[model samples]
Target: MILSRLSIINFKNIAQADLSFSPNINCFLGNNGMGKTNLLDAIYYLSFCKSYSHIADSQIIRHDEDFFMLQGYYDNNGNEEEVYCGMKKRQKKQFKRNKKEYGRLSDHIGFIPLVMVSPSDSDLILGGSDERRRFLDLVISQFDKNYLDTLIRYNKALAQRNALLKQEIKDAALYEIWEEQMSVTGEEIFKQRKSFLSTFIPVFQEFYTYISGGNESVGLSYRSHHEHGELFAQLAEVRERDRILGYTTRGSHKDELEMTLGEYPMKRIGSQGQNKTFLIALKLAQFDFLNRNGFTSPILLLDDIFDKLDSQRMERIISLVSEERFGQIFITDTNREYLDEIIRKTGHDFHLYQVIQGNIESLKEEK
Candidate 1:
């Protein structure tokens, strides 16, 4: 899948712009707060129907603007596809495919599979368990459409159970109903997550090895209550305890993906560069996984990811994506030197743009 064109209006700092892209690479150059990252986020919104950093939809609209719009033209295999999104303050956002509105936004997710690696990815290690689980869900949601529906069902059940707990309901039968639902849906999610990680871990490790030259070994392990023998039984056992805490304590929502460097927790031991390397490798592996599983290679988005890396690591990343398997890429950077070196190393057709404030102009393109 290739995003051949993108049109935006009142999105973050971008006032209005329509631009084309190179099938190979499209690079954006700008300083901090110059709207480079927002441009990438616009493309990300087109794919995932949300922003990479997870801000409120209203906040994404340009200041003093009541509404925003984004449209993308894509080439999927031999078929042409058009995606459109429009939002207004205090109103529902409309998403359409080929100009026909979608009844459910979830249906549009995997249709344009994409993998984004941004500086915010550091949250995976530095942040809490929720961050890692989100990474898991985002990757799986792209390849498995029904996974999101299952997750939604599980969350609803968990919420109901929690609400009952908070209300101090004396009804054991009500508790049984939601607990049973949670067990069923949560177990399915657990199985799929486990299955995805079984194949994902090795690919992640391989990418890390190549990027870091195997100087240090990294590892990821899944932690879940499901392995404790039946989510239903565990939830029943924790029922009384959950009532005391006013929340359901045992479910997939509490599962975690632990990150490690050389057998120790990455959060405590990893230096800045090491942590960044870990995230970049992880995202590249995500791209690889979606490429192998999806109908076409997924688009790659890199948001200010070249900030802290050394020259060798950057070159390895450039070389890896330059290969044929990875498709269209959108990259944002503050340094011209890094983008220039990428152009030289990849030797692929590309478009380079300069972003100033909220405006974007095509500075150059190699046809």
Candidate 2:
């Protein structure tokens, strides 16, 4: 799918803009805080129904603005798809396709598959287990709607079980109700997660090898309690412990994706460049996985990720994306030289835009 055009109003710092995009590559150039990333976020919203940076919809509206609106025109397998999203202060956000609003926002996911690589992705390496679990969820959810729905049900059951544990007078019957539900749903999620990683790890490793020139070895290990025993038994065994902690202590929610550099934790051993390279490779692998599974070619978004990388690694990434396997890329960077190099190397259809304080102008076009 290609986001061929975008319309934005009062979203973050972008006051208003109407822009067209190339199907192959589109580049946005500007300094930090110039709304370059915000432009990309607007595109992301059309796909995911939420901001990539901000958790709250109201927070992303322009200061003092009543609301924000975003719309995208997509070419999905040669069929035109119009996606519309709008939000008002203190009201539920609206997301629609072809002028009809979605009854449930999750329904919109995977319609326009997208993979984003940004500086914030370093969190996958340095942040908590939740971050890693989210990475798995995001990629898997894009291709498998059943997995996403099961995850939602699992989380809901987990939440209810935790609430029961927190109650002063917990009923064993009620606890079992949620625990049973959690166990069933959690098991499905665990199987899906494990099954996904089995196929995903090699792809991830391949990209890492290509990016790092096979100079360093990396590893990804998925750890979960499901491997030990059934989730129902685990939850029952930990009932006392969970009550004491005021939360469920054992489940798929605690699953971790351990990143390693030569058998050691990357967090403690890898340098800045290594860490960045690891994240870029992971995202690209996700793109490849999604494309191969069912999404044809997921849209790729690169947000200010060129920093802290050696020239060779940077060139390798540019070369990789320039290939025909990738499709409909959107990139944001402060350096024109990098964008220029990409254009010179790919020789594919591209459009460059300059962003200044939420304003945008077409810089060049080679179609």
TM-score of each: 0.98, 0.99
Shift in Å, residue 26, candidate 2? 0.6
Q: After superposition, how far is residue 316 of candidate 1 from its true place, in Å?
A: 1.3
Task: Write the residue-wise lDDT of candidate 1 on 69-181 in tens digits.
Answer: 99999998978999999999999999999899999998988999999888889999999999999999999999898899999899999889999999999688999999999
Model 2 regions lying over 4 Å from their true place: none
lDDT of each: 0.92, 0.91
Candidate 2 per-residue C-alpha lDDT over 1-367 given as tens digits, one digit per residue, 9 for 90 to 100: 8898999999999999999999988999999999999998998889899888747898999999999999999998889999999999999989999999999999988888899999988889999999999989989999899999999999999988888778843667888888898889888999999999999999999999999999999999989898898888888888988898899889989998999999899999999999999999999989999999975689999998889999999999999988888988999999999998888888898999999999999999987
Cα deviation of 15 in candidate 1 (Å)? Answer: 0.5
Stretches of candidate 1 off by over 4 Å are none
